[model samples]
Target: MMATTHALAGVALAVLVGVLFPESAAGTSLLPVAAAALGGLFPDFDLYAGHRRTLHFPVYFSVAAAVAVAVAVAVPTVTTVAAALFLVAAGLHSAMDALGGGLELKPWLGTSDRAVYSHYHRRWIRPRRWIRYDGAPEDLLAAGAFALPALYVLDGTARTVVLGALGISAGYVLLRKPMVEVTQAVVDALPDEHLDRLPARFVEDFR
Candidate 1:
């Protein structure tokens, strides 16, 4: 899924948490929403290094999130609620990767088997391809689906953020395939030395 999609999913989860626990700090402040959105984007930060393998701990994050949720429920401070939402969002992002296309230059081609890394299992999980690929039309739909409740419930800055994400998601869906082509063109024109420094996926298929 697109980063926006993941962020929206996190926001949706936070909103759900707020609805379920109206008296909690999560319902009163945007901190937990922000935390969850950031957490959703956190795992993708490893995109340059190991991609899915570096920080996408599907099992471990889920376990930690479970514990964190328990702690938050027991005390329900702003800090605990934010922390719990963060872990839960991160875990959700990691696990949700399995439902998308694989990690490759052209994931829509269905060529790669690896969707996300599972350190606990010491292997890669295969892509389910339910959404085909990030930035696909279906991905935009998924983003919209997650954004609905958030847009309905949130106001001020949070609502603006969701709108911005929706716009970005729409633009990305249009450019996703073209961006890959442009990257390939740029990579093809680069010198061998520079190409060597680029990520393997960028050069491997072009070479």
Candidate 2:
């Protein structure tokens, strides 16, 4: 799944939880909702360091949830909202990654990545090649399905959750190839000496 998909899932899960348990849902304030939606992107932060191995770990969210719950014991209203948002974001992110065959789940923990993915791999029971990162019809369809509720259910800053999802999907579809070409062109134009100084991943991917 792509970042847009993860973000859309975050918003959809938040709203679904809100509808399912109205009493426990976040308030009209956008902070809680925003927190959860943004958390969707948190796991990907590891791209700067270890990709899907550091920030992508489920334990990080568990700790955040635990802290939120503890805080809720004292400040029920605000903390409850934060907790719900965080859970939806982290939970959905992990689930999507696992299903997409992109999750390793052993960041900072002494766990086996192969073991984790192998267990999750059983859920699909098909070849791994079928799982694409983006540009699949299913990605578009899923984005549309999730966006409908987000666009109509919340307004102002809240609406941005779904709106941003839609925008990201559209942008990716419209720009990914062109951007890749542009990046490749730039890399091609650069001298070999400069390329040698670039990050190994960048050089390998574009060269």
Candidate 3:
């Protein structure tokens, strides 16, 4: 899914957590929501390195999040709640990747088998293609689904952020395929030396 989608999912999770524990910091402040959103975006930071494998620890994150949640529930504070939500959001992002398309220049083509890496399993998980690909029309829908409740519940800066995310998601859906084509064109024109310095995925299919 798009980073915005993942972040929105995290926001939705935070909203749920707030609803379930109205007395918790998650309900009282935007800090937990911010933490969750950042966590959702954290795994994707490995995009330039190992992509899904570098930081996308589906199993390990889930385990750590389980423990973190227990700790937070035992003593809920801004720090504890934020930390727990962060881990949970990161874990959710990692696991959710399995339900999307694979790590490919054109994931909508469904050509790659690798969706996410599971270090615990010592292997890659196959793509489920539940949403076709990041920035797919369906992906926008998913983002919207996750955003609606958040928009309804959040106010001030958090609400603005969600609106901004929705706009970005829409623009990305329109440009996703075209961006790949543009990347391919640039890759094709670049010298081999320059191409060699670029990320492998940028030139793998084009080369």
Candidate 4:
């Protein structure tokens, strides 16, 4: 999925998990909660690169956790679990992004990139390495953006789960069509010379 969608999902998931298992949630400290949210954005650091977004390997997650723990020790505000969850959320979001397809997730072992979020590998190590950034499907992005907040509100109950599901459905139905219509309008509004520059995918995919 796109970084935005993954970030939205990660935030909502953390909130939902925090709410559902309030007592057992890893992040007891507010610092950790914030850290987790930040950590969730960790994998996407690749956006700084010239290429698209992709998942870092397990090593990246481990390094992130260790760095977070060390930082927590100095800060003395967050706990081990809190920092760990931050890394885990980032890793999870990276993993889920693969489900959207158009790319493969491979483990980036060795000192390939950097320390924490160095590099990524393909789901398969083929004769020819083919790894690309996998953005979220348009409908999935729209559905996820809405569903995540709904899930957070639902907070993991059966009723809330139902509501979240409905919200996802509604988003898929509404956003996709409206986005297309809006794109058409924009295209029509733009000068003929600028038509080539305005890709419809931008309107549909970019929320």
Candidate 5:
């Protein structure tokens, strides 16, 4: 998986849940969906500071939920519902990371100097799994970061949206990764001195 994948997966799941569950839908408001999309990847802010663990934890999530609830109460419509929707999206993101077969997110904030890694998300028929990092489990929720917006206009049944979005996103990711891989391959062909100047996250040194 990749960052783009995680985001799309999360959006696909949230919209599907909201539309089908109706119970999750915050009425006509798109606020919750927006919040959820934002919250879904809120955890990834951690990557920027290299200390963004809190953006992903239950405690932080609780705070976000409170804010969402407050907005729901204040606006009391699709706006308020947006808050609830956000909670669902963020919650889903966290839960997925927790149960992943190959990945173990920084479960609790302030517990590690570095994020832990495993294959926890790779399980079969897993339950309530979070769609953490779409790119790789070690990463944050990057895929869903993009997927959420694309799915916003997704029309039709929940199942249909998921199927459609999944197909589109998976293809997008596969296409992107190989280009990166090829670019990296070219970089790998370069002499060590030439590669030394490239940034780590840059495609030139995509290891």
Candidate 6:
């Protein structure tokens, strides 16, 4: 799935959390929402590490979160916030990736030969691999399903942002293929220095 979809999922989940647990500090904190949104983007950083191997491990993050919580006793404000953010953001990031039939979980306990693809599904229902990495029609449908309801609950600025995010996500799903083709064609026609100066992620996408 696309990063935008994951991000919106994280935000929507954070909102739901707030609704469900309004009295909890973590639920009320903007940090968790920001962290969740950012966390939705975090797992993709594996692109720089080893794509879908190390950072995608659920146990690894769980242990790290445990440590953070343990240390929070000494610094309640900072560590408490950090722990919540890490759990919500990174946790959901890996989970969304896993749903797409990717992600290597429990990497420490098992060798690469034994690594498992983590997912959420039942025997009666298929997993979330209905869409590919980018430009899946399913992405729009799923995101809209979540985003539209969020609009009804979120008020003022949050509602506006969600609406804007929905537009961008929909645009990306619809235009990604054509945009990639056009972008690559434009980049191909550029001179060496201009191409070299382009952002690495943007250039890498074409390759």
Residue pairs clashing, model 1: none
lDDT of 1 at 164: 99
lDDT of 2 by residue, 59-170 (tens): 4565566676567656657557666577658755754565443322211122222211222233322213233435455666777787676676788776764777787787
- TM-score per prediction, in order, is 0.98, 0.72, 0.98, 0.44, 0.50, 0.64
- The number of clashing residue pairs in each candidate reads 0, 0, 0, 7, 38, 0
Our tally of clashes for model 6 stands at 0
The CA lDDT at 50 in model 1 is 93
Task: Give the Å shift of residue 179 in candidate 5.
Answer: 4.1
Per-residue lDDT over 29-72 for candidate 1, one digit per residue giving the tens place of the 0 to 100 score: 89999999988989999988999999999999999999999999
Residue 5's lDDT within candidate 6 is 75
Query: What are the RMSD figures for all models against the true structure?
Result: 0.8, 6.7, 0.8, 9.5, 8.9, 8.2
lDDT of each: 0.93, 0.59, 0.93, 0.48, 0.48, 0.59
**Distance from true location, Cα of 31 in model 6, Å:** 3.1
How many pairs of residues collide in model 3? Answer: 0
List ranges where model 3 is wrong by over 4 Å. none
List candidate 1 stretches off by more than 4 Å: none
What is the per-residue lDDT of model 3 for residues 56-118, given as tens digits with 9 covering 90 to 100?
Answer: 999999999999999998988998999999999999999999999999989988999999999
lDDT of 2: 0.59
Which tens-of-lDDT digit does each residue in 32-129 have in candidate 6? 66666776667767765555554565555655656664664456563375455566566666646545532222121222231223333211211345
Winner by TM-score between candidate 2 and candidate 1: 1
Off by over 4 Å in 6: 45-58, 65-82, 101-128, 186-207
